[model samples]
Target: MFANIIILILVLLALIFSISKWRIHPFIALILSAIVLGTTLGLGGESTISVVLQGFSETLKWIAVIIILGAFIGEVLRETGGAFRISNRIVKWVGEKKLPWAMGFTGYIVSIPVFVDVAYILLQPVVESLSFKSKRPVLYLGLSLAAGLTVAHTLIPPTPGPLAVASLLGVEMGRMLIINLIVATFAMIGGILWVIFFLKNSWIDYDKKLQDIYKEEQTTTHNELPKGNWLLDIMPIIVPIVLISTGSFVTDNLSGWVGDALGFMSIPLIAVYIGAFIAVFQIAKKDKKNKVNRLVEQAITKSALVIMITGAGGALGFVIKASGIQNEIVQIFSDFPFLGAMLPFVVAAILTTATGSITVSLVGTASMLGPIIDNFPMSPEIVAAIIGCGAFCVFHVNSSFFWLLNRLHEVPPKVLYKTFTAQSLIMGLSGLIGVLILVLFGV
Candidate 1:
């Protein structure tokens, strides 16, 4: 027992160090960690290989489909000028004085169906336009948008990270979604206030380097398609959420009807795919030339990469669970009187900080804590919220989201480390406090 505990701790530390300090890819690092964990725990070479392969296979089943469909939907939206139409309509409705708030709202809504990085990329031109017109630092508008999107992407369900955690822990999606929306809203407000407070008066002189990049981005125009109605543009994004939420409610409350007519009608994952199909047809039919083939090809290509990455993270989590290391760790943590309640959050934060992959953190933490929750008198909803909160605590060089911000907004490495990193830390800690309070109240 003692030996296994030591090995587990060592494996975790090594995984973190390799990714954070040595700059190793998380996919490589996770596989290596699985091998070391299996070997140290007395799983033979063949067994370890089998375990890893099985893990990968199991994760790819559902994750790959969801990610691919989600990505395809996002790509179609971007190419069809759906995102631009939505942003422009939003800005016009809210007016320039309230554009920051509008951008924040847009980020929160759009990011539900789109990946964080892709959503940011889609809205970059809009933000740039606002900055140019306002003659203010682009970082202010960019960060506001980023905060909204990141909070929802990290904390909300139906997105891969939070959904993975909730699924592993057997938490109901409806409950998780309720908690996620509440916490995410608070986190977004905190982030927006932080950005506005700091960047409101700060003058960022437009450097020649940035100007050149901006000019280049402006010139790279694709085919000009007709501007779709704002309602049509926004529906593709909202349909998935409505479907998933409805499905979750029915499945949880009306289990007898799950596969029955009403229950079959409510399956969220199915809703997402159906929504994707609708989005493709709607966007493609509007185009005059080779619409069907072009839309299908674009959707397939765009979704493939994200789906692979998500599946890889899932496979890594499965290996960890199958190794028995997570079970042992849970037992050890559960024995502690005070630490047991806090174990999920702490483990999640540590894993997230180390792997720089929220998906990995969710899988690792949820896998380890699953048994603990079953044995203890705690709400799985609280456990899910804690894990979600911990996943955003630290954003550093290892995190791709950090780099996305730096590259997209032309933020210097130093500024990113100072400002964006600080904002994440604050958001994370505040979330932790919220979780801790819930735990304290035995909620």
Candidate 2:
């Protein structure tokens, strides 16, 4: 038992150091962690190999499809100017006084179906436009938007990170979605308030180049498209969520004819695909080219990269389980009085901080803590929330989102650390506090 515990600790630490400090890709780092975990727990080579392959295959089957379809949808929205149109209308509705809040909300909604990077790129031009018009700092506006997108991408469902964590813990997606919305709303509010209270004091002088572009909007090579209907643009994204939530509600309560009918209609994945396809074709028809096909191809390519990285992380989790390392760690935690309940959050935070990938943190957390929860009588909701909350803590250099803010928004390192990084830390810590309070009350 002592040897096993030591081995688990060493392997986990190594995994953290190698990934964060060494700049190793998560896929490679995860595989190495799996190998070390398997060997430490005395799993036979053949069994370890089988577990790794099976885990990758099983996880990819479900995740790959959703990601691919979602990516295609995102690409289609981007190419057709749907995202830009929607954002512009939102800015107009909210007016300049609440522009930060409006931009944050736009990031939150758009990120549900779009990749974070693509979402940022799609929306950057809009923020730039806003800055030019208002003569305000683009950094504040961009950071507010980044905060919204980051929170949703990491904490919300239908995105791969939280979805994978929910699946690994055997929690329902609908429940996860509901909880995610609650947590994410708080996080976004925190970010928006930060922008209003703190960033408003700082003045951002507009660049000469941006001023030139703003003046020549009509003659510029890229002209803004006519504003599209906000309802039309938003409906495609919301349909799947509404259908899934309604289905889950019916199946949970009614459980009769009504429930059966709703179940038949609830098919979320199908709804999403159908919605996306319609949007793609509609945009293509209006434009008179095969833009839809090109967007689909781009989405697929992007989705492949995300799928492979996530699958590799899943394989690491499976290897840990098969090798008995997870069980051993669970045993160690169970022997402690208060540690079992807290272990999930602690380890998840550590992994997330080290790896800088919430997906990897989720995989690692579920692997180490899922069996622990199974050994206890804790509520799965609480456990799921704990995992989700834990994954949010400590957004630093290891995280891609960190570099994204620095590079894309041109936020100085000090400002990035102060605003974007601090926002993530606050969001994560607040989530954990919320979960802890619930756990205390036996919720």
Candidate 3:
């Protein structure tokens, strides 16, 4: 027992050092850790190899298609200017005084199928325009938009982080979507509140510095922006969420062909594929066949690295389970099962702080916790949500998104810390609260 505990500690320390200090790829780190753990735990060469392969293959079987399809949809949304249209139209509706609220909601919607960083960039112009006109601080709007985008980007699927964790933990896609939307909505609200209280007072002179610097670039990009229809822009994203939710509801309440059809549609892979098909037709450059093909290729190439990382995570998870470390830990902590619920949140927060990559945090923490949580009494879906919340926490100088916001707005460091970083912390804590409520009510 003592030996197993020591091996587990060593594996974790090595993982953190390799990824954070040595800058090793997570795929390599996870795979190496799995081999080392297996050897240390007395799993022979043949058994270790077999376990790793099985874990990797099984996890890919569930998530590979969904991840690729989701990425393709995101890529198309990104390249087509549809994502920009969605945010621009929505921001226009709410008008100036409520600019922060509108941008927050826009980011929430836009980020479902687009990366948060991409969403931030796509929506930055609208934010800048609003801030310029209203003379409101850009950080207010930037943090608002980022807050909404961050929660959905981390918690919800079709986004890679939560999707990978959900798949590895065997959470059904429909259920994952439904629960996360509820949890993420609350988390987003928390973020919006933070923006109002913390950032509303901080002001930057957009007309003097930012306007002179960015005016030309903004005008040129606005003219070149793709002119796509709004309905077509959102249909691909909305349809899947609706179909998946409806299918989940129907499968539970009804029967016969209708239920069976809903069940088929609700399958995450098929639902996402259907959305992808819809999105492909709305390509911003539909006339350029070569460009469209290239976009698809780009998405595929991007997804390949994510697929390998997720598979490697599964390999490490399988080895952990096989080593019986999970059982020993669970027994040791038997009196505090609630800690099991909180474990993912704490570990993911630490990893994200260390690595500055939410995907790395999600995949790595989920890989470490997935096996043990599988044996826990609560739902794995909830555990995945907890991990997602943790991954969304505390973005600082180390985060890429932090730098992007700084470059775009040039907010003072103190305001950036209080606003952007504080809002993220609010979102994460709010999500943890939501999870606690669910656990308390015995969900």
Top-lDDT candidate index: 3
lDDT by residue (1-443, candidate 1, tens digit) is 77887877788788778877888766777678877777778888888878777766765666556666766677777777887777777777887787677888888877876788889988887777676666557777887888888877887755777766765677776667777777777777777788878877544544333455455335322113355776887776777776666665665566454446545544556767776767765565455356656655775676665445445555555556666665666666666756766677788889877777776777767755664466544688877887777877677877888898777765777887767777777777677666666666756
Model 2 error, position 434 (Å)? 4.4
lDDT values for all models? 0.70, 0.72, 0.80
Cα-based RMSD of the predictions, in order? 4.0, 3.1, 2.7
**Backbone clashes in model 3, listed as residue pairs:** none
Model 2 poorest ten-residue lDDT run: 216-225
Which candidate's TM-score is highest? 3
**TM-score to native of every candidate shown:** 0.86, 0.89, 0.92
Instruction: Estimate the lDDT of model 2.
Output: 0.72
Q: How many backbone clashes does candidate 1 have?
A: 1
Q: Tens digit of lDDT per residue, candidate 2, span 1-443?
A: 67877887788788788878888777887777777677668787777778878878866766677777777777767876777766777777897788888888888888888878779888877877777677667777887887678777777656777666765666777766766676677767776777777776444334445776677443321235654666777766777677665677777787788888777656546656766766665474564556766777888888776777778777777776676655666666667756766777788889888888777787778765654557644676667676767777777777777787666655666766777667767767666666655556655
Question: 1-443 in candidate 3: lDDT tens per residue?
Answer: 87798888888888978987888988898898898889889998989989999989987886888877877788888887887778767766886678778888888888877777877887777777766666677777888888788887898787778878886787777777887888898898898888887777777654367566555435423345677787888888888888876787778998999889889988778888899889888864546678668877877887898789889988988888888788888887778876766788899998887777888889888888877876665788888888888987778877789888777777666666777787778898988888778878876
Which ten contiguous residues of candidate 1 have the minimum total lDDT? Answer: 216-225
Q: On a 0 to 1 TM-score scale, where does candidate 2 land against the true structure?
A: 0.89
